[model samples]
Target: MAPPLMTVIGAGDIAAEIDRHRPELTEVVRAAYLVHDAGDSSNPHSSFLRFPHRDRSRIISLPAYLGGEFEVAGNKWIASFPDNTRRGLPRASATLILNDCATGYPFACLESSIVSATRTAASAVLGAQTLLGTRRARRVGIVGTGLIARHVWRFLRELGWEIGGFRLFDLDPAAADRFGAAIGSAAGAADAEIVVADRVEDAFTDCDLVLLTTVAGEPHVHDPCLLAHHPVVLHLSLRDLAPELILAAQNFTDDVDHAVRERTSLHLTEQRTGNRDFIDGTLGDLLRGRRRRDPGRPAVFSPFGLGVLDLAVGQWVHDRVVAAGRGHRESGFFTGAED
Candidate 1:
């Protein structure tokens, strides 16, 4: 009998590999959604650990088992502290632990902030492609200028989305300026106009595509008129829109049950409306043709950040790292096998 080897993958290795395969990761995310929709996965509701006095800080545990082609089980433990930005640290950090399904033994541990952001960005890009039914947009607007927003922009650029320009808005004016500068300096964006928006409404006006990645705890954008352009909105951060706006749009989510909890905008919508009828379908439904987009109304995709997605992407990264001989492998991680 032999003990199962455990590999530790760090952030640098993960980032390098993922940066090279951003487009491919979109397919990975799509496949994970299909598998989960087929009932081949178990994704429990995320459990949040909150500090007594720190209302804006939370550590969440997302546990999942993805069957079918990816026979792996894992959990992503991630923390979000809004105040970390003041200390010159990223607001979110994470770790992923992957277990072999057959043996139920932990086989890999990976630094997962990159993994988390990668999957999230991949999902957002995929959602945009599917709902918008196009690889190009005349103009794109981003509401938050943070790590996830940056990743989404990179995925869009790497995937070769043709955009005429980008309008960026953030609560912090400096963050918006920095994000606009990054876009201005990027490789494919030299021809694209970058503007730092003076108001949040400016991010939605006349843009065919909009991204909401803010850290807002509750709904603030109460005006449904901001969506007059009827753009495909990627509500990535999950808490930025008001109930009226959610009800006014054609809503799609990663998982209805998951999204309609945690006091998310959709959750608040459900509470106010006392029904789930406003939700059009899951992203899987859209992928499988069970649901179709209504071109007459605004399209909004809200994903609850599925745990199976993290597992699927993490497993892929682990396999790729091991195949490349990049991760550090420990031979005697589990000692009881020799006994």
Candidate 2:
């Protein structure tokens, strides 16, 4: 006899399943912890696999332990290239492999590029709900017009937020127009309108929620003035916003310890200013109601994509497919029923 064979799915299938099962998937995220210092760094570092790339760069493996009704181990490989934009590609691309804890076998190997995008968006939405108080957010300002931005928009729409309109900006104005058109076409008035901006500052003005999902590695990309106006800012891409913006706010992270260890913009700021005190709370604290948001200070969320999220979502996909007899089962070893 042999351990069960895991089935792998592609990007499109995973994206569709993620859309259909977002709430359940997000619950998994809410339950998991962020793991940093996995011994690698492109952005959010984790330990698992580190493979070299075309230009002496490397793809780091991010693994996490997920416990509960769902028990499993998994890791996602993230490849980085600051020059990917030149080829019309994102700076990072990833793949996920879900493994069985009982047998230590690779059960499923799914294309996780889309998974990465959706989960990141889902986390941002969860963070907003936690920090901003769902009732308080009516409008959202999106600073990037890319894949991640599209996913975030859809997630917010699903939450039934009265999104008054969106302020869209991109290095490529044409890309911004294309994104606006797509959102307007699919969401109709639910998307309200897409307002294009000439600069990052123009986008943040008068918005209740601001989502920064750019590839910039510097802090000044997010002018203090821009963030000073927005009540809640979700730093989805880890370190896209300024340290000044972070220091000025009641900073909350998905995992404060992990954020610090990974040297995200939050960590860098702490190092530069010698002020680790800016960290106000973690998502777990807020979710568990152990901490409450202070209305006077601006709220910020910096979530480093956690492995538990991938495992949870992967488990969901795995179980559903397995129950339907959808994945291929190959023989290898069963050694014994009891060992």
Candidate 3:
């Protein structure tokens, strides 16, 4: 006899599970330390499984260990392609697997697109809470309005900020509209006002908090002067800001090692300029009270999404599903080899 094969979840179920377990996930993210960087070339990429129905491309397997309250480990497999946008498909699709720590047995498999998005957003929210302090941010400027933007909006709403005064700008007009509508509807008690900006600069005007989520591949769109006057800026996408912007700001990353390994736009700028001292500290260090906030300089939070976040969130979702008897177990799925 062998251990039973567990049920596989789709994207919708995974998103719901993530929403349900978000609070616990937030605590896990706050405790995990950053992984060490091994250079850009050493960073892992995804593997592929093709299907004739979808004209298969690539699936990425990302794994990590988080040591803290949960004490668990897991990996996330993401299916992605730039072309998926044409068919109304997500550019990156993902699935997460959580394993039992003690025996290394398979625990549960769930959708990770939502888990990935929410964790990314929650990390930003956490950064804001730390860097921005209790100052009531009057305006929030968002540069991108894609999946990541959606969750960032959700988490910001949870933080009890006013959403009605949000300034949104995206390369796609329709995306900006969609994000505004969705955010406005979900925001409760907050006078949510969404404004569509004609240009990126228009979005940044007089905003106390700025979030850049573009895939522009370069930092030209983000003008340091625009943010110089702003209180706090969250550069969630690693490459969205220029090197000068990074050097000028009091930069902080979720993990110093992983930030460089991901070779995000920020990392590339640092390399191009031959300046590494621009990075002030890691988010983990700050959260652990090892690093202090600098009141004189503008704060920048750059998080190269971590695998540990997925593992912790995945474990939380799995436990909830199991408690509810939601996943079906397939017995004798894997047979042991004869000794």
Candidate 4:
């Protein structure tokens, strides 16, 4: 009998393939969300590995199994180091492993930094469209100019969103300027105005859509007045808004239990408010017409990065790479393991 084949997918290959299938990838994420909501998935609470000395550095393990169309199980091992950006590197790096459910053998190892960012960005954009009820925004605000932010913007543009202007805010003005320059040079945003906001609150002002992608380990955004325009906020970072702001908004998350842990902004809000009533419902509920967004307040969507999403996207990438005769396969990866 032959051993299970294991293929390794690199970042470049993953990026090219993902670029070719942006719209399909978004649908894949949306389907994963629906599968998870229908109780066809097992997504355990993510485990955090924090360093005692380096308080801001941590690695996370997300283990999950999706049972519907994608009958696969996997885990994403990801590291987040805020200081890495200071050394001119990305703040997050990740790898994904896919396991065959029947045999429980790992068949693929993927460079998943791009996978992580892509899934996160796709989920964010999906949440935005679900909550906003429209794809055209006269003005948009982005609160972090990092790699994840870049990917979210790319997804928004590539998915045929009509965004008029973008206001960017970053702790480092240079980073904001660089992101602005990149946006200016992108294919679809040629006519859009790019402005670097002087303050974080400025990112939320007068914009119909807002993306919060900061690396803040705690709440830094406290002003609810900044959200007076009732923007649809994609809180991808999860820990940026204060309890006051969360309480004041119409909240939606990928999962209630998942988002209400890990001391995220929702967790902090629960701690302060002494209940979970602040949460409106999951994005799935909204999509399924079980819940409706209140147009009276700012709608904030916080997704606690689900592992099933990683598996779904990773499996898609793996299958495509294999079909196209790309990626490196190790034939003897599982040879004579009983020895």
> Mind giving the per-residue lDDT tens digits that candidate 4 earns over 190-297?
999889999998888889999999888899999888778888989999999999889888999999999998899999999998999999999899989999999888
**Candidate 3 local lDDT, residue 138:** 76
Clashing pairs in 1: none
Task: Name every residue pair that clashes in candidate 4.
Answer: none
> What pairs collide in candidate 3?
46-60, 163-192, 164-192, 164-193, 239-265
**Which candidate model has the greater TM-score, 2 or 4?**
4
Q: lDDT per residue, candidate 3, 1-339, as tens digits?
A: 246466666666666666645555666556544332211112233334666765535566777665545666678888767578888888887778776667666666777888788778888888887887762577889998988877876676655565337899998999899888887676382366679998988777877788888766456564678766745788887777777677778888866666864457667766887777778887767766778778777888888777776776676666766777676655554455353
Could you list the CA RMSD of all candidates, in the order they appear?
A: 1.2, 4.6, 4.4, 1.0
Tens digits of per-residue lDDT for model 1 on 17-69?
Answer: 89879888898999999999999999999999999999999999999999988
All candidates: TM-score: 0.98, 0.86, 0.86, 0.98
Candidate 2, residues 1-339: lDDT per residue as tens digits?
457755767765666577756677666666654322222212244753433455434566777756555667778887766578789887668888887778777878777777777678788888888777873455567777887888887877676666677888888899889988887876544447668889877677888788888766556464676656647888876767667777788888866666775457898888878878888888877877778988777788888677666666677776776676665554543435476
**Model 2 off-target regions past 4 Å?**
33-58, 82-91, 188-191, 261-263, 332-339
After superposition, the stretches of candidate 4 with alpha carbons farther than 4 Å from their true spots are none
Estimate candidate 1's alpha-carbon lDDT, on a 0 to 1 scale.
Answer: 0.93
